[model samples]
Structures are given as structure tokens and as C-alpha cells.
Target: MENHNPPQLGNQLCFPLYVIAKEITGLYRPFLDELDITYPQYLVMMVLWEKDGLTVNQIGEKLYLDSGTLTPLLKRLEAKGILIRKRKKEDERVVEIFLQQSGKDLQQKACQIPAKMQEKLNLSSEDLLELKETVQKILNKIQK
Candidate 1:
């Protein structure tokens, strides 16, 4: 068989994944705008909420971001008064982040986002679970 198909990664699964990720992020834009943050910022905030005082690198690891990205993102959060970055006294080089009162306040207003997202995705609970499991399985396999 000729297998007469395009072989570009951009034309395959990666492309849809990229698009879906971007689109979903965009779908979150309106809601996030209310908080004056972007989706990536929201992800960082969520991580900080669960674990306050995470190191910059730790946040990057969790969000799949790097210093180059985290530096600016963290700065923006700091500027927004949502987070504060400080170097450890002992290390002096390791920057850690802590969410401020405004950040915690943002949480109270964001509590409804999950419900809104559920309605937007329109996926049944079973469908959502299966999708999550499938994606996690793929991620686990790929990480190996």
C-alpha cells in the first residue's frame, strides 16, 4: 500500500491536541479575564493554592513551564498583587512563591468555574472519566 498520507507531525494527533489545548485555554479566557489572569497564570495559581510557597522550579515542573516562562509569569502575578516571590534566606538563589490575600479571594469567586466548564464541555461524567483515564494512560506511557 502506498500509505499516501501526509507524514507531518503538525498534520496528525499533535496538531489536534495543540488546537484543542489552545481552544480550551481560550474558552477559559473570559472567565479568567474577570480575575485579570491568563489560563497559564490560572494553572500556576491553582498549584499555589494547593501548595503554598512552591519554588519557581517546582511550579515550572508542575505546569511544564521553564524559568524563561515562569519568570515573566511570576512577575506578572506579583505585579497583580496575587503572589509574591522571595529568595530563600539560606540559598538566596532559590525563588519561592506565596499567594497573597487577593489570590485567596480569587478562589472564592472561581469556585463556580468548574461547574461552568462542565456545562461548556458537555461531556457526560462517564465520558469525562474515560477521557481523563485515556489521556493519563497515554501520558504515563510517554513519560517512560
Candidate 2:
């Protein structure tokens, strides 16, 4: 005899992940809107905040984004005066992103976002760390 269990939304792993990602992004929207940056743009800024003067390709690699997607987001941030993309003097073909004064200032304001988001999430520190570690383990396995 053959099993007759049909696939359903409840049985799919992607469904919960999709919903969680959407909800998390939604939770960030108000805070992001205050800074006038979308979630993907925010990810780029966070990377730059940690290490400034990275090339476009470096940022793309870190964020797992393609040039087509990153280019427009970078343009928007550049237009906002948050960053400047300059051609490297030694190799003009290479463009490096440097944070502007505005971008640095924005970092100070953005620092509070994590704590606020945590408060919104309302999970214990222990629980949060465990979840993060578990997700990271899964992500590492997937990446490899």
C-alpha cells in the first residue's frame, strides 16, 4: 500500500520562514522609515558601518546580493548623501564605498535600534541567543 499524504502549506518549511522573515522586516519598517532606508539598504549600511571603504563587489559578497540589486540601492543611499562611491585611484574600474559624514552620524542614531527591536521582540536574552545560534548553524550548513 502507498501512503496518500499530500503536501500542504503546514507541512512546508518555507512557509514559516517566509512568514517570519516578512514579520521581522515589518517590525523594522517604522524604525527604518525614520532613517529613510529600506531593509536591504539598511543591511548594506550595517556592513559599511562595521568596515568602511569596501568595494561594490565586497559589499555584494558580504550581503549575498547581485550588482543589479545592489546598484540601485547604492544609488539611493548615495543620493541621500549617506555614502559616496568612488573609483579607486590605482584601479579606476574598482569602485569603493566610503561613508559620508551623514552616514557616520546616522550610525549613532541607528545604534539604539537593536535594543528597541529587542524590546519589541520581548524574548529573553538566553532565548534570543539560542535562536540566533541555531539559525546560524543552519545557515552555515546551507551555505556550504
Candidate 3:
């Protein structure tokens, strides 16, 4: 007779990673709610704040989202007057996203979020940097 070992959730790396991700996002929920945006929407806003007039495909690439998922999110932001999308005049097939006055204004308020989150997490700068570096290393390996 052959003996078999059963899989255990406690032994799986994914289990803890999933829990940590959920908890971290939960920590951001209240802050994001005050900004009237979800985490994913906030990511899009951050990308635009860094550089405006990026194409739909460009935003999708940065966010790791597909057009199907990104379209509705962009539509909601457009309806909220946070941004506007326009097709390129020369290449009608390409669409670009631009931030509005409201979106630019939102950045001023969002500037405080990093400090607030750091306070909430109660982690020292060194600890936070270590965690970020570890996660980036894992992500880099996974991407390959």
C-alpha cells in the first residue's frame, strides 16, 4: 500500500499572503472611502496624477488590468468629473485618459494618506521599507 500526505492550508504560502493582502486593503478602506474611490480606482488615479494623457492600454499595463475591467472604472471616474477620455485624433483607435480639475484637486487631499496609513500601521520606516522590498522581490520573481 502507498501512503499519501494531504495538503494543508497552514502550510501554504498563498494562504498567509492572501490574508495579509486582504487585511492591508481593509486598512486602506476607510481612507479610500473618504476619497470616494475604491482601491483599484485609487491606483488609476495615482497613475494619472504621476502622468496625465496616458492611453487606455498604457494604464491597463501599469495596473495589470484588462480593457474589459478598466473600461467601467474609467467610465465611473468620467461620470464623477474626475477624468475625461478622448480618442487620439490621428489614431482614432487609441484612447487616452486625462485628469480634470477635480482629479487634480483630489491629489492635494490624497497627499496626507501616506502619513495616515503609516500612523495606522504603527510601523517604523525601516520596517515598512523592508516589507516593501520583500514584496517587490516576490513580485519580480513571480513575474518572471
Candidate 4:
């Protein structure tokens, strides 16, 4: 097969991964609309849920996002009343995110999402785990 052409569309892996991620995120759009947040905003909320009061730098680190992306996204989330942004008391230069009562309340609605996503994808848990591991391996390699 050395002389043969490389694998085409049907044999490719990355194309499907990219397409599926985009499509799946699209699926969440309507539901996310009800919450009045975009996919990136939802991601920000999830991160904040786990650890509130993180500096913009810290949130960007976990999300692989930069200030340019986080700043505007955080602003929108703040405008929606889900989060509050404030300058840190100890460091005036730093901005930290704090979840408001509305944001905390959002978790209850957000809990329904995972189950719906699973039903939509219809992938078995084992398959999902394997895919996650494979992607993690690639991320590790790329990071190193």
C-alpha cells in the first residue's frame, strides 16, 4: 500500500471527530437558548461550578482559551446575570468570576443536559470512555 494513495474520507478518523463535535454542540443550541447561553458560555459555567472565584487567567488555563475569548464571553455571562465579575481585593489587576444566585440555580436545569446528550449520541459508555482516552493521549502528546 506504500505506492497507493492515503485513506480517503471513509477511512478518516479526525473528520468524524470534528464533525461530531460540531454537530453535537449544535444539538445543544436550542436547550442552551433556554438558559440564554452559548456553548462556550456553558463551558465557562461548568468550570465555575466546579470552582468559583477563579481568576480570568486561571479559567483560561483550564479551558485553553485566552483573555480575548474569555473576556467577552465572561462579559456576556455577566450581562445575563449568571455570573459576576469583580476585581480581586488582593490584586487590583486580576478579575475573578463569582457565581450569582441565578448561576447557582442554573445547575439544576443543566443537570438534565448530560442525560439528553447521551440519548442523542446513543454511544455506549465504553465507547465514550475509549474515545476520551484516545483524545487525551493525543492531547498529552501535543502538550509535551
Residues 34-125, candidate 1, lDDT per residue (tens digit)? Answer: 88888889999899889999999999999888999889999999999999999999999899999999999999888888778778999888
Q: List runs of model 2 lying over 4 Å from the truth.
A: 1-4
Q: Per-residue lDDT for 56 in model 3?
A: 93
Query: Which 10-residue span in candidate 3 carries the lowest summed lDDT?
Result: 1-10
TM-score of model 3 vs. true structure: 0.94
Pairs with steric clashes in candidate 4: none
Clashes of each: 0, 0, 0, 0
Question: Could you tell me every candidate's TM-score relative to the true structure?
Answer: 0.91, 0.94, 0.94, 0.89
lDDT of 2 by residue, 35-129 (tens): 98999989999999999999999999999998888989999999999999999999998989999999999899899888888899998888889
Q: How much lDDT does each candidate structure score? A: 0.90, 0.93, 0.95, 0.92
What is every candidate's alpha-carbon RMSD to the true fold? Answer: 2.2, 1.7, 2.1, 2.3
Ranking by TM-score: 3, 2, 1, 4
Q: For model 1, where is the 10-residue window of minimal lDDT?
A: 4-13
Of 2 and 4, the candidate ahead on lDDT is 2
Pairwise TM-score winner, candidates 1 and 4: 1
Candidate 3 lDDT over 36-91, as tens digits, reads 99888999999999999999999999999999999999999999999999999999
Candidate 1 residue 89 Cα shift, in angstroms, is 0.4
Pairs with steric clashes in candidate 2: none
> Could you arrange the candidates by lDDT from highest to lowest?
3, 2, 4, 1
lDDT of 2 at 52: 99
lDDT for predicted candidate 1 compared with the true structure:
0.90
